[model samples]
Target chain A: MNPVKVILTLIPFIWTIGMIPFVNRVKPIVFGLPFLAFWLIAGIFVAFICIKCLYHIDSKNNQDS
Target chain B: MSSESMALAIIFVFVIGITIVGMVPGMNKKMSLEEWAVGGRNFGRWLNWFILAGEIYTAFAFLGASGWAYARGGPTFYILGYGALAYLVGYYVLPAFAPLGRKYGLMTQPDLVEHIYKSRTLGILTAVIGVAFLLPYLQLQLTGLGLIIETCSYGQISRVQAMLMAFSMVAVFVYTSGLKGVATTAVIKDVVMIVAVVFFGLYLPIHYFGSVGGMFEAVEAAKPGFLALPGGTKALDVGWVMSTLVLTSLGFYMWPHFAANSFSAKSADVLRHNAVYLPLYQICLVFPMLIGFTALLVLVPALKTPDMAFMAIVQQTFPGWALGLVGGAGALACMIPAADLLLSTSMLFSRNVYGKTIGKNTSSESMGKIARVMVLVLTTIALLLAIYLPNMLVNLLLTGYSGVTQFFPMLVLGVFWKKATKLGAFCGVLIGEILVFGLILGKMDPVPFLGQHLNAGFVALVINMVVFVAISAMTYKPESNKG
Candidate 1:
């Protein structure tokens, strides 16, 4: 595996672990959303982006193969 | 009808409709035995993610996590804490299992273990333990469903009647759809649960306490320990937290439905993607615990069973329509896990025990038939257990965690280590079971070395690893099966 690919894979894992402690500390506002709402909505957004990235990589691998 | 009874009747009818609709896809498809048992090994990334999440976050997550948070306070955070770490760990571990699952056409954990060990006796042993462990877990899911019905119906519906109603729906769908039923219903359940969590997580605090911050502040003032880590009590110290995290994280994948879903993933990458994306599902839980904590703040002292906290809060805080929606979501949360467990238990009996041992040459149609029969049998057993001898939801779930984690050494290590011998695996498993049962029987109370409650799982894992390594070192190497 490429080192860059490995690091990219680690991003969500690291981000999630970091979020645990930060869960208690978030200031309760994001564009009118409460802190928990804002954080969860943001998580859904990140998940969407990650899914797209994974799809592209998988499709690219399929085309190359 | 009274308001609560009317609401419950509507929810039951809705759930039954969902289960029937979910069974349609599997009924239409003519699946071979392997496909029925393992989803034909063709699930895409998204389907696998939904199914895996549905399986892992069970009635336990809905009821047990909040209940623990309600009763034990900060100690219950270990549920999410361990689950997050488990996802990261699965990113590495599941890939190894994926390729092997694909290679052997394995349908259950026992198939994978037996393939590695080349021993039918070993296979049967693993199957027996897996079935034993899974039964209580399945019963716990049924018990959760029973609680929901009993609560919503205001005890008009007996627990036995409720379990039969719930488990029978699960049995019908699982018997018809197999893994397809589990996957299909999981998608619906996941969407419902996610929406419900988002709504309740945000709405309850604002509606009841003015804000999430206000809710937390009130809880902090009343039960200050609920907000702190490791809980405020000496019983839930830092050591207990660390031990629980380790034990549960290891136990996560040992779940039968997890193994079944792992087998169903199209590729290793799909499983890895699931591990990466799955934590997002935990977001649903954050609010449920808040709901439980809010109940602590708002409710009278006598109404304190953690199992009833969320329901009590909903009854007190919400209007009729909103309460119905919460009831529906909680019902789905409990039902989805119940359905998954029923399907997985059926697969274990048919594929691992019957197909591999009793009827080695069973045809695909016959195997599928046997699976359906086993689903009925297991559902009956779980319903009976739930009706007569139901346990406290949280402790019952913990007992399952301890039992399932006992398989970790064999399943996890067997895949990566070519040097893992059958004898070593057997010894490791034997000693692990001994320690687990011994601890359960009070042999290691006060924890021989550690002054903590000493999770039987952690002790069993230590013994398992030591025996596995020592026995493997002394035994001659087995011939490589791979070309």
Candidate 2:
């Protein structure tokens, strides 16, 4: 398995499931949004970036193979 | 003309224009089942983007997401959350299956199962299961179309009339144009939907609550706990949300249409490129959820049918033309997914079940003809079901996720592990479906395991894994390596 692929997949897990407890709170609003709402919006971006990195790694792997 | 008449006119014009867009691709051309079913395996990045978006973000994304937000609050986040997670899973899972699709001329997800397990019966079984789960989903699109049209017409057209009109047109275009038609219409649907979503998502918040933050603040004050996990609904809790997110995301691409659509990409890298950008669409979903939240806070005495929440808000807040545009977008959103589902279910039935068994040795032309007929047949069934056996949008989709997720273990194990036997795959699917359906029929709480009260679908998955591994261990033979 490509290390990059493994690492990238884990990003969604951490951002979504892992941060649920801490970010699940209603207080400590970030950017006018509750923490949970902000968490989801930000988690999507994080997942997007991870996928972007995976694309780069995958392209390189495709070239090598 | 009254504002309602003008809105209706705009919607009618948009619908007529897009119906033409849907048919133009395969117009005046001879297409075999191959071309009709998989777009001749020639989808480039942009085309793939449109098709994927069309398939993934349906009326469910627009209406259902917001509806859940308006009615239930925080659990609505799971929609986009699972979407992003699904794309992440796709980044690895889908690309792995792409090679097999191209190599074997695979046109459907069941075709992939047949190839991997070398079992025609299993392929047919997979097709049956696909149809079962997919009916409610396809029904969802048609139901959404009916809702959009009825709402736009301001009760000028009835729901049954709207569904019959929309679905018959969709059936014709899908029959004539095939996947190409769905793909083309998807391009239009997605553009219109993005504009509508962004407009409502942003405008509603700021217009009503001053800023997006201000909307959250209002909800937090008036309806406390509406912004947090498990929010205002007793039906959901943090564990349910967390487990559902994990399960749905993991099972995301297992939807038969999604798996088959993977074959539409030009190559694995095209799919990879799509995964990277697809989440941007999901991010835009935040706006719809915001719209839902705004509606919850602003619209007094909450809506009876929350599915109407988004459109009701549009009617209340926006002018006639804006409402028309939003309605047009919603209608197209409904049609795009409906077309894909119609094509997929028809193709699977014709190719996997009928062609392999009763109509063996049939020519590709004959198969294409049969597939078209099946498209009409399946459309009527879905339309009838949509009108007669109505359901909440998010509930229908969640039920679909449960059914389709049964495919996850088989596909994942089949690709990564050579030792996963055919018996294991079969037993796993059977047991998973039985457990899930049993739990549903019996009205039992999903067994508590792993510190979460897992849904029947996920619980069944764990047991299915156990059954698969145990059965495969017993049945293994060196001759099985022939697979």
Candidate 3:
């Protein structure tokens, strides 16, 4: 129900939709890595960020409660 | 043993070792019934993350997804899309249930339903529906394990023999560790599955078709539908795709094992944090589709069973060592989830149904004993069903999904809407489930009424919603109870 939380959650869903049409569009390089490998690694990094954000929010809420 | 058999033996031994560790008594040394069923409601964030990931991505996701892709072309991508969609939906619904689970120390979907409805008849009906649907779903995992063993052994071990071996291994761990066994095995399964999927997803396409572009080119040439959005005669048609996605997304959290795991978490924060990271677990699925796409290129038309597609590709294409590893990972994927399903359902049968109704004062030790015994009985029944059943793996899973989703109206409505009366909830579930089962068995076409391709689940959900809203509208509201 939190607007910020909802927006953050939508990030991955939107990212996934973008990747769909172009997933097969292979690139020679992304930061000196194959496109597929690079994309997956980047996604993992983003996931970590999201996890950290969520953890912070949850901890703050817990403190308040 | 042959070289392949020896490799499998080592993997099996490792799996058994983990299972034994899980079964050790002190791992879950709590006296309360809630502690026994839901891991004392004290799993940490890391454990919760791993457990939730493991439960969601079963051998079905690994083997079944690729198999679907190979057999059905682009339509199978819906599996990946649907899974992600389901997780997103769970993120929203899980928070509502976590507090309730903590307050009531609930263990199963029926426990929550019965609490809200306060009806013994509804409780029993929910349990029966859950167990019935779970039977085929569990059997599908067993069957997946059997195929993995049979394929890796190269016919030295028959499917039935492999199934028996895998089933016994699961039963032992589940009997010993209960949910603890499932949790430990899940960590191992997730590691193996993620590594295998990522490796294959990247390696196989390039290995077989030279590149992703080449893979698509081949697919377009052979089966144009593979490039189509919905894929294959619109097998992923707009309506079907949306319905399947929404149904499964809403239905995923309703599974009894998930509820049990949610309750097991140390705090509600653990649940929230775990849900945020859960999508990462599904990253493995992207590769299974690649494997499926690769299989279509390399495999001949004669080799086209939905279950065999992934296995056939590995056996025919990969080297002996790689094939062995894939097989081991596949078996672990199936075995971990099967153990969890078995243990969770046993806990449900013992604590929720038996303990609540038959013996109110059953001790934790007695309940644990009953749980182990039920594990044996349920696994035996599921084993028989797996061996004797004639349906394809994917179809069998859909049947279970549809049947289990009947509980959706009860759980989702019960928590969010205070106006939802106990009578309305019970009547809604009953009418919905009966109609759904009747349609499935009778193959009644609801297209006449809705003009859309409707399955048992969609039909049941419609009737359930109607009854719930109408009855709730008419009936008097109970005093504002927090639960």
Leading candidate by DockQ: 2
Compared with the true structure, all predictions reach lDDT values of: 0.71, 0.83, 0.70
Clashing pairs in 1: B35-B40
Candidate 1: where is the Cα deviation over 4 Å?
A1-65, B391-397, B443-454, B478-483
User: Which one wins on lDDT?
Assistant: 2
Best candidate (score: TM-score): 2
Model 3 agreement with the true structure over B74-129: per-residue lDDT tens digits = 54554555455555566657777877878875677778777777767677777777
User: Over the true interface residues, superposed, what is the Cα RMSD of model 1?
Assistant: 5.8
What residue pairs clash in candidate 2, if any at all?
none
User: How does chain B score by TM in each prediction?
Assistant: 0.93, 0.96, 0.91
The count of backbone overlaps in candidate 1 is: 1
Tens digits of lDDT, candidate 2, B381-459: 8876777667634444555777788888888888887778899999999998888777765666455656556566777
lDDT of 1 by residue, B114-219 (tens): 8887888888888888887778877877777778767766677777787777678878887777787778888888777777767776777788789877877666
